[model samples]
Target: MKKILLSSLLLLVCHIHYAQVISIIGSTSPAGNWSTDIDMATTDNITYTLTNVNLTTATDPGTTGLKFRQDHDWAVNWGSANFPMGTAVQNGANIMTQAGTYDITFNRSNGTYTFIPAAQPRVGIWGPAVDSQNGFGGPDVDMTTTDGILYTLSGFYFSSGSAYFRVNDNSTLTYGSVSFPTGTAVEQGPSIQVAGGEWFVTFNRSTGAYSFTYPSIGILGDATSVGWLNDDIDLITTDGFEYTLNDLVLTDGEVKFRKDNLWTTNWGSLGFPQATGIQDGPNIPVTAGTYDVVFQKSTGHYLFTNTLSNPEYSVANVKIHPNPSNAIWNLKHDTTIDAVTLFDASGKIIGNYAPNTTEFQLDGSNLSNGVYFIKINSGRDFSVQKIIRN
Candidate 1:
């Protein structure tokens, strides 16, 4: 009877030890040596937390930050190279942390941990367009965090207006830029004048690097007239939400619609003539024929009609303003441009440019120009525009 009673007592002690065994240890993690254990507090035993834990010293952020162990022993432990927040595993690498006082939370159930800095605040966007969707004077559209440095908000419909990021959602601390699509964030800066559309937005609180995705959808693939080039058959958007192309000639191949000619977001499907597409879907099939295509942006629905007869939409649309100018001339295209070369009527190369922009401003005051052929290169295709300077 005594033997069974002693065995039961041992089991109870083991259960108690297992239930109360989670602590941190490291260099400058409030501990100069690894021989000691600093315990954590837990109410449910599933989530362990340690508040106001200093993970580094004042002079330097030590290379090795901290790791979690159970019962002051390494028999069951969790560690990871990722810091601020990450899922740790048994026998993993050491967690490297930055210099700051943090309230740390570690999930005993999933091995996920988060180190939230005390000094850093939340970042969010505020504007009329955001207010329309998120509601006026409501909570700002909050950007989420992983490492707590770069914050992001995706697929947000920000109507063309002004927007900016404010610290803690209501603080006077602000980060803004001059324009949309791409720019660096500036404190106490002017409002960001958006191009007005739905886009993926990102902002880095540390470096102030931020960008909004451009809203341009184009057709690509071997089935396109341009064929496997980085170039796209630019579409026309009368409503800014749907794109269309008239007189497009395609051979028997496959195609897809990508945003801004980038594969970051794309649509494809099996059905032709009309169908709905999904992101990273299968390539869309095509037959040898001329087609008029229409695509819905918000939804992936598309339609193709081969009955229309109009100009072929296989070439880049370029406009040369003030072709006959004294000093300055402007060039623009529907798509991203690569290079521009100037050739005299005598078939001699007069000027060469590699300005990768939608618009190129040319100066012809130095040239005694009677007639010059300007070649604009987009992807593998090229367009020759005329310039007359008298």
Candidate 2:
């Protein structure tokens, strides 16, 4: 009877501890008032996450307060006057939160917490061309998108096979793939079949509009003539390497150089008149003028000479054969290379080199299957290219 009584008490104590749900409450909430709670989820008792929660001052302005409470009760709670991350204190000051959707993480063990700006929800591809049928074989190849709805993968060399998109990979949120690249992308929808050889791939998440365009690097965004459509004003080339778009007009807007008019392979972030375009950088800003634009495909050196409103965005495509090679990838440019840095999808540096040579080779076999970016520097010129491994 004593053993039975002890077991009962132990079960009761365990149940109470396990049932202690942590919640985010106080002035900011999707519920519009401090009267409600946004419960956080946890797989382990130590760390809790409240995902896709909107903490706004829009509805209740000036009340940008936030806190984490146990079981939606005030008795057990934590707060701190911190923007992103800090150690929590019981009955502490409200966190001054910015108005945005966030993935809030709290470590119950150490009272440490963070409000990380949520990554945009996105989708990616799995195919024979990318990861050797890596759907069941390996991780899907992630796509790039300025607008979260339209995902793109460019300059993808194919061996006459097909692919599918699995709406989630590294993001905290999950979604479904579009089959045809046109129409509404429904959850549990049939997998997409995209096929070709060396093509630019684009898939729309909201509307299942997908396309494969023969690769060509050109200017895109609202600042250009076409205004953000796929109909990019193609850059001209004489030697098939250095590209030029002479006598072009731009405006006081934003623009980026892209391949096949998609964000799949693009360059921006270098400043006006002349600058080295970073791969997948932010949109280049144009104050206003018409100009002569120059782009070195091998080096990513871009120059905009203005006579009218603004300068210009220009680009050229660098082809990859047998996708570089089996074990090593070579970067060959006309100018002297000072340094090289390779980054993974998470913006984490995986490889760094100081070759200082026009011709440089790096091992590709060591990289895991996924998307990677290689940045090269030559004098003031630089180039960033997306490298893929299956």
Candidate 3:
């Protein structure tokens, strides 16, 4: 009987120590701004969980403070004196953390807790021999993220082959292979076979939403000569990321730039005629005239203006034709005087000419079939134009 009584007392003591109810409190809450307790859910007697707990810091959203307490009381709590990300503490200061979704676990038996950053939604592309720019056999091309959640990547050239999305750079953390419709969750199933094309892609990791946009970006609408036709005047990539649509004739009509020649994903600006810049905000209005438009994708800074007038924005009046020229090329301009210089693709000076006249012929039969730049210094105003010689 004495032995039985001793065992009963020991059991009571163990229950009191290991089975006490624990809760979480913090500045950004479910914790009532640290004034109240948010009880943690428990599955086993020794394990507790608080899933999807939102947290933030005191001064900055990226930093956070939090702690664990017992029975909605602060007299007994767990925190860290060192305040490490995953370090456990008892009767200590609040734990420091960054703003993110977390799955926090506390083990009563060991006085241990795990503060894990939840698996974030991310999407990347990995393929088998897609192209040289994105070669197959592993290292995937990651999309750029602005908000750390949604991501986008554009200007990808893919051959007829298969690819898939992954949560991370790791090939193991991948989604399903089948070509999911836009907004559908990409599962970790099979590789998606794609036809040969240049593409744009976007992904939302949170909802498994993914989409592949075709390379159908062009100038269209009644403002343009095409007027909603499939033959949209395509923009050429000048600096890879930035694009240029040259010599577009628009009547007095509304115009916009769009992708896939669709109403969706269109860009324009109500703030038109601003000498400062253009952006992808509202529909742009145009007066009748021919113009060259430049769009900087990374900055959304664009400009549409008279090609010849704005030397800063347009190609120079000096014209080089048969641009994809062969051995012989013609250079013509109304203004004359000063030096003309030719540069290779790498900006290396190839030839210098002191023509001192308006018209000149460039003998380039010796040049290769690639891109070049011609810098014309007409004594007063100078401009650089790209030349492609075949």
The TM-scores, one per candidate, come to 0.38, 0.36, 0.41
How far off is model 1, as Cα RMSD? 15.6
TM-score of 1: 0.38
The lDDT ranking, best first, is: 1, 2, 3
Residue 346, candidate 1: C-alpha displacement in angstroms = 47
* Tens digits of lDDT, candidate 1, 1-390: 999999999998887766857998877577756677899999878899998776663222344567888878889888887878999999777787776678999998889999987655688888765875554355678876544577777656676667788888764788888866688988988888776556667799899989876367899889887765557888886444557788888989999998766687899999885677889889999887888787766556677767454434323488888868887889888777788877664435778998898898988889885766676766544555567888
Tens digit of lDDT per residue, candidate 3, span 1-390? 999999999998987677778888877555637687888888666789987766654443333467778888877887763322455666665676655667888876666777677765555777862543555565777776534466777656666677777766777777654663354545666776665545677777667677766445577778887876445787877333346776888888877777545554567776454322234456677787778776533333456767556444223577877777877778877678367877775446789998889888888888988777766666445556677877
Query: Could you say which candidate leads in TM-score?
Result: 3
lDDT of each prediction vs. the true structure?
0.76, 0.68, 0.66
> Tens digit of lDDT per residue, candidate 2, span 1-390?
999999999998897677668888877667756778878888777799987676654322235588888877789888888777899999887787766678889998889998887786657766564666553466677888644666777665554444556676632233334443333444555544544345567777776667665556688678777887446888876433346787788878988887665565788884876676888888888867777777755445677766554312212222233453556777776666788888764446788999888777778887777666677766654555667777
Task: Using TM-score, rank the candidates from best to worst.
Answer: 3, 1, 2
Over 4 Å off in model 3, which ranges?
Answer: 2-18, 27-64, 78-94, 99-123, 128-139, 142-162, 166-202, 211-390
Model 3 residue 378 CA deviation (Å) reads: 12
Q: How big is the positional error of residue 337 in model 3, measured in Å on the Cα after superposition?
A: 13
Residue 111, candidate 2: Cα error in Å is 6.1
